[model samples]
Target: MRVVILFGSEMGTAETVADSVADALSAHDVSVYDMSDFAVDDLDVHDFHVIVCSTYGDGDLPTGAEPFFDELDACAPDLSGLRFAVFGLGDSIYGDTFNRGGEIAAEKLVARGAIQVGEHARHDASTEIRPKEMARDWAATLPVPALTSA
Candidate 1:
C-alpha cells in the first residue's frame, strides 16, 4: 500500500517518531513530509495518511502543523475517499488536553469526510518508554486498509 507519513514537531520528538513509523512501514511504499512543507492542495485521496503531531503550548498544534491546518480548513476538501490514522505526542501531566493536538487534527479530517482507518494512538512524553518505539509498535498494528471500500 502507498502511504504518506506527515509530521509536525516542536522539540522534534514527533518528527523522530514519524521517522520511526515510516521506517517500520518500509515494506510499503511510504513517503515522508513535514506538515509545513506538504502540499495539501495536491493531496491525493488514493494514498493512506499517517499523521504524527505534537501538542504545543496549551494543547495547540505545533507551529509546523498550523499552516497545513489553516489550508485544510480553508479548502475544506471532501476527503471521503481518504484513509488516515493519527499518533499524538503529549505529556499526560498537561491534563485533559494531553493529546489534544492529534485529536483536533483527526477530528478536522473526519469532519472533512476522511475515513479514519484506525484508532488514534496517544504517546506520553512523560513515560519511560521512548516515543519512537511506541510509534513503531503502534504503526505495526494499524488497520491501514480498513477503509478500502469507502
Candidate 2:
C-alpha cells in the first residue's frame, strides 16, 4: 500500500524522525511532506499515514502543524476510511503534558472518523533515546492492511 509520512516540528526533530520512517518503509510506495506544506484535503483513504509530531510549549501543536489542524477543524472532513499511526516527540519532564501534541493529533483525527492502526509511539527528550530509530521501528510495525482493504 502507499504510505505518506507527515511531520510537524519547530527545530526539525520530528522531520528527522519522519525521514527515518520513510527509510524504513522504503520498500513501499512512500512520500513525505512537512505539515506546513500539506493540506487536510490531501488525505487519501486508500493510503496509510504516519504522523511524526513534536510537542511545543505547554504541550501544544508545533507552529508548523497548527495551520493544518486548524484547516482540518474548519473543514471537518469525514476520514472514516483513512488509516494512520502516530509517533510523538516530547520531554517527560512536563509530566501531564508529555507527548500531548501526538495525543491531540490522534484525537482530532479520530474525531473525524479516521481509524488508527498499531501502537502510539512516543519518544521522551529526558531519555537518551534516539527518536529516528524508534520512529522507524514503529513505522515498520504499522498494520498497512488495516484499513486499505476496507
Candidate 3:
C-alpha cells in the first residue's frame, strides 16, 4: 500500500500537519510533497493522493498550490484511477470562502474523475488547539485502501 501527502502552506502549518499525517499512517509507503515542488504531471503516477492546503489572501489557493492547479487545467489529464481526500486549513472569519482553497482542489480532482475516499476536513485556524493533531486523527479515518497493509 502506498500514499502521497501533497501539501500547500503559506506559513507552513500544512506541511507540519503533513508530517503528522504521514507519521500516523501505518502503511509501508508514504510520500510527502511540498506543492511547490510537485509536478502536476505526476498526478498520473500516484493513484492515491491527499491534499492539505491553506487558503491564502482573499480566500485563494496558497502560493505553493497555484502552479499545480494551473498545470492541471492546462493539461486536462484523465484522473479516473485516482482516489483522494482533502484537509483544509483556514480561519472562519472569511465566512463563505473559509477553506475554499482545499475545496477547489477537491472539486478539480473530483471533476477529473478521482474518487474521494472519505469525509473532507476543515480546520479552523481560529481554534485554540493546533490543527496538526486533529488532522492526523482526521486522516486516519479516511477509507483509503492504501492505508491498509497488503
Candidate 4:
C-alpha cells in the first residue's frame, strides 16, 4: 500500500509537523510530498492520500499551495478508489474561519470521490493542544495495508 502525504505550510510550524507525520508513516512504507514541491499530476497515481495543510490569513491557503489548489479545483480528479485523511493546523484565534483551508480541501476531495477514513483532525496552535501530537495520533490510526512483493 502506497500512501502519499501532501502538505502546505506558512510559518514552517505546519511543515515541521508534516515532516514528523511523514517520518512515522515511512515506517509503514508510505511516501510523502510537500505540496509546494509536488506536482498536481502526481496525485492521480497515488492509491491513498493524506492532506496536511495550514490555514492562513482569512482562511486562505498558504502561498505555496494556492496554485496547486487552483489546479486541483479545476481538474477535479476522480478519486473513487482513494481513501484519504485530512489534518488541519490553524489558530482558533482566527475564530470565524479557523482551519477553513483544511476543511475545504477535505470537502473538495470528498466531492471528487475520495473516501474519508476518519474524522478530520483539527489542531489549534493558539490553544494548549499541539498540532504535532494530533498529526502523530492521526497517523497511527490509519489502517496499514499489506505489503505487496514487487
Candidate 5:
C-alpha cells in the first residue's frame, strides 16, 4: 500500500520519529512529509497515513502542525475512507495534557470521518524510553494485511 508518514515537530523529535516509522515500513511504498508542507486535499482514501506529532505549549499542536490542521478544519474534507495511525511525543510532566497533540490530531481526523487503524502510540519524555524506537515498533504493527484490507 502507499503509505504517507506526516510529522509535526517543534524541536525535530517528531520528524525523527517519522523517519524511524518510515524505516520500519521500508517494505512498503512509503513517503515522509512535513505536516506544514502537505495539503489537506492531498489525503487520498486509497492510501494509508501515519501521523507523528509532538505536543507544544500546554498540549497545543506543534508549530508545524498548526497550518495543516487549520486548513483541514477550514476545508472540512470528507475522509470517510481514509485510514491513519498516530504516534505522539510528549512529556508526562505536563499532566492532563500529556500527549495531547496527537490526541487532538486524532480527534480532528476522526471528526472529519477518517478511519484510524492501530493503537495510538505515545512516547513520554519523562521516561527513559527512546521515542524513535517506540515509534518504529508501533509503526511495524500497523502494516499488517488485516489492518489495511478494505
Candidate 6:
C-alpha cells in the first residue's frame, strides 16, 4: 500500500519518533516522508496518510506543517477515496489547547473528505502516554491490504 508519513517537530524529539515510525512502516514496504521535506501538493497521490505532528507555543502546529495546513484549509482537497490517521504530540500542561494542533489537522482533513480509520491519538509528553508506542499501535491497526507475492 502507498502510505505517507508526515511529521512536524521543534526540538527534533517528535522528528525522531516520526523517523522510528517511518522505519517500522518501511519494514512493511510502506513509503514515508517528513512533512517539512514532503511536497504538499502531492498529498493527493497517496492512498493512506499518517500525520504525526507536534503542537508548539500556545497550541500551534509545528513550523514545518503550518503552510501545508493553510493550503489544506484554503483549498480543501477532495479526499473521498483516501484513508488517514493522526498522531499528535503535545504537553497536557497547555490546558485547554493541549494537542489542539493535531486535532485541527484531523478535523480539517475530515472536512476535506478524508475518512479517518480509527481514533485520533493524542500523546502527552508531560504525561504517561508514550508517542512511539501510540504511533506503533496506530500503524499496526491501519487497514492496509495484504501484500501479494509477485
The better candidate by lDDT, 5 or 6, is 5
In candidate 2, position 9 carries an lDDT of 95
Compute the lDDT of residue 145 as modeled in candidate 5. 49
Question: Which pairs clash inside model 6?
Answer: none
Cα error, residue 99 of model 2, in Å, equals 0.2
Instruction: Give each model a TM-score.
Output: 0.94, 0.95, 0.93, 0.87, 0.95, 0.84
lDDT of 2 by residue, 1-150 (tens): 689999999899999999999898887788999999999989999999999999999999999899999999999999999999999999999999999999999999999999888999999999987898788788878887733454
Overall lDDT per candidate, in order of appearance: 0.88, 0.91, 0.85, 0.78, 0.92, 0.74
What does candidate 6's lDDT look like per residue over 87-133, in tens digits?
A: 88888898998998788778878887788776677888887757777
Query: lDDT per residue, candidate 5, 1-150, as tens digits?
Result: 689999999999999999999899887788999999999989988889999999999899999999999999999998998899999989999999999999999999999999888999989999989998998788878844434545
Q: Give the Å shift of residue 70 in candidate 1.
A: 0.3
Question: Local error of candidate 4 at 122, Å?
Answer: 0.4
Candidate 6, backbone clash total: 0
User: Residue-wise lDDT of candidate 4 within 1-150, one digit each (tens)?
Assistant: 677788888887667777777876776556767787886677753566788889988998877667777887888887687788888888888898999978887887778887877668888888887778778887877664533444
In model 1, the Cα lDDT at residue 56 comes to: 93
Per residue, candidate 3 scores C-alpha lDDT tens digits across 1-150 of 478889998999999988988887746478999988998777754557889999998889999899888888888888887888899899999899999989988988888888877878999988896798888899779877754456
In terms of lDDT, which candidate is strongest?
Answer: 5
Question: Any runs in candidate 6 off by more than 4 Å, and if so which?
Answer: 146-150
CA deviation > 4 Å runs, candidate 5: 143-150
66: Cα error in model 5, Å: 0.3
* lDDT accuracy of residue 80 in candidate 1: 86
**Where does the lowest 10-residue lDDT sum fall in candidate 2?**
141-150
Model 1 lDDT per residue over 45-111, tens place: 8888999999999999999999999999999888888889999999999999899999988998999
